[model samples]
Target: MAFTLTFALIAALAGPSVAESRDELEKKKNGVNSEITGAQQSYDESSKAAGDAAAVLQASQAQLADAQANLGSVRGQLVAAQALDAQMQAALAQSEADLAQAEADLAVGEQNVEASTKEVISFSVESLQSGDPGLRAFNDLMNGANPTEFTERKAISDTIADVQLDRLDTLDATRVILDLNEQKVQALRDQVQVERDAAAANLANITVLEQQAAAQEASVAQLVQANSANKAAADAAVAEDAALISALEADRARLEAEIQAEIARTTPPPATGGGGGGGGGGGGNASGKLSYPLDSVRLTSPYGYRIHPISGVRRMHDGQDFGSPCGTPIKAAADGTVISQYYNSGYGNRVILNNGVINGVNIVTTYNHMSRFAVSPGARVSRGQVIGYVGTTGASTGCHLHFMVLVNGSHTNPANWLP
Candidate 1:
């Protein structure tokens, strides 16, 4: 399991903050897409090697299947984790830089505030007429370490900046700016701590994964050599993994059903400018067709019946697995409301979008194996907006988008809708 560190903010931000968030999201999305492209090339090369390993293996079909299954996973998981580590490293660096800059800004702001306060105090002592408002205002500003007006900061700022009669107003404005700088510094410091902790955890996981990858890579040749004892070990490991996935999926399916029911119940009549039920029509912009959830789609697996990689059981795949590396930007397939965003041990981090009816078929889409989500559940997203980053989570062998679609409450091929 990868460390899908989702840092959620609790503030009920509005107005310009919303626009600022979107701009930041777009910038981060672009960065992830660029990094993922490079990482994807490396992951593909390892995948190709796995295929070539399978072709050359001279073993029983069962042995080959089981061994290929585990080896591919081991190799792919390592690469995916390494890519995630790289992204964490980049983020950690940026956070450190931000923290430094914020501290520097605060220091400068504090100096300016102190200087302005002293200048106002010294000059106003001589230049003031008796009972002047400027002298009284300066008295209030200096008397308290944090003025009682600090609680009424907005009112204080409006009075001072709008009705500037003297240098005292300039001093007052400097103090308000200083307070804002302090808040900014504290926020940056908190961000730095979080990134540092996540980076450390990621590095620890990668160390263990690297060892597993090396052992699995070596076992590929041993499995091909038809070692009976090693074969049993591989089978056991595969079975254990499959059982875990099965459990997670079972729980996810139950929860997902509840989520769908919740959406349907909350949805109002379409005649009243409300959306449809059963998976479609939460309604942002889905009208006629759907867009691909990923910018670059390399279909490693397709929707249909296929032999399961871990369990070797033939079952419906139910989604299109696009081979993207960790940190790849995942887009909304259509303008829709995010009805659900949650993590399953088997699905990793997933976002279910309730896209409006397309043509006549009510449509919904899901993006899975996410490193982190940009949009929260209930957010109305536009088509092609970045919603999350691709990651290797749950039962993933590597970083990819396991994109699924449902039409009117029935599982359907994503390819049928994606252009």
Candidate 2:
């Protein structure tokens, strides 16, 4: 019994009657529409997220710029410090030279003082021992002779000794002056040493500053690299967002087309036995009128001014073509009275229906390329009802339904009339 029931259920599901359920078709159509909407929403959210990322990247770039500027400032300071250090080094070297010169001057002064002392001692010995009368008298006067002799000789000797002594004193004064100059030089040397030490300390500071500058520069470089990477990511995100938008748009268009097709399939055919003429009862209902003349067919040609497929020339095409198997069912486009069902030079096996007077305006619909007609002249039909079958009739090419819409007998693009 279970096996029999399973077989029955499978048979029921496989049947054409089950496959053609309107509710199932509607559900599938809604599902497609829903997918399209969901894709569009996700695309929008991704785009917004990409924009936010871009903003963050911009801020990071700005920060990187500031970091670079600071690095440059540090580098400048480092350079200045290096220059000052060089100058200080030069000054220190000069100071060392000055100190050496001061020591040499002091040595020279000491040597001069020793040489003057030797010369003074030798001159005194020579004055006492000289053989000349004045020198001998001078020497005797120094030894304390008689009063008159002592007075004259002592005066001459005293005068000579005084002169010699003054010379020695002058030499001694010169040595003292040299010693003072040496002291001044030593003082200058001390000052220079102090300056040199300070300069060395400053050079050490410069070294530290250089290190800081290098670190700053490295930071700037890192920031630059990071900023570049961020920008690239942001650009990629933007591109992805754009691509998603395009995909969403395409999906939306596909879903809209499917929805329109579903609506056409499910809606009941318009009544052919209408009170007034023209495609359908006018006003808003006209907008909802079925657009396609047939179902389950591929579009062969679209309505508009198009290049003639055979002639390769710009030509005005007044209708659309739906390629279908021969004898495929064609239906009335809208509720309207059948105005004419006849053949013509260009349109063979054609039918013209007056839709109705809608908003006080008359509209007509035309169908061509019929293999066989189901309705007769003056017969009424409803929308979606098979009125004829597809054929390659009238100025024909392949098997297709040639459909047209006329507003007051003027051919217009059929897409405008169809949903």
For candidate 2, write residues 7-27 as lDDT tens digits.
322332342543332333333
Span of ten consecutive residues with least summed lDDT in model 1: 1-10
lDDT of 1 by residue, 275-392 (tens): 2432222454434668888888899999876755653434457678999889989998877656557776656788867665667765667788999989875466788899999999
Which residues of candidate 2, in runs, are more than 4 Å off?
1-15, 121-160, 267-419
The most accurate candidate by TM-score is 2
- Against the hidden reference, what TM-scores do the models get? 0.40, 0.52
Pairs of residues clashing in candidate 1: 281-356
lDDT of each: 0.63, 0.64
Can you give the lDDT of residue 224 in candidate 2? 80
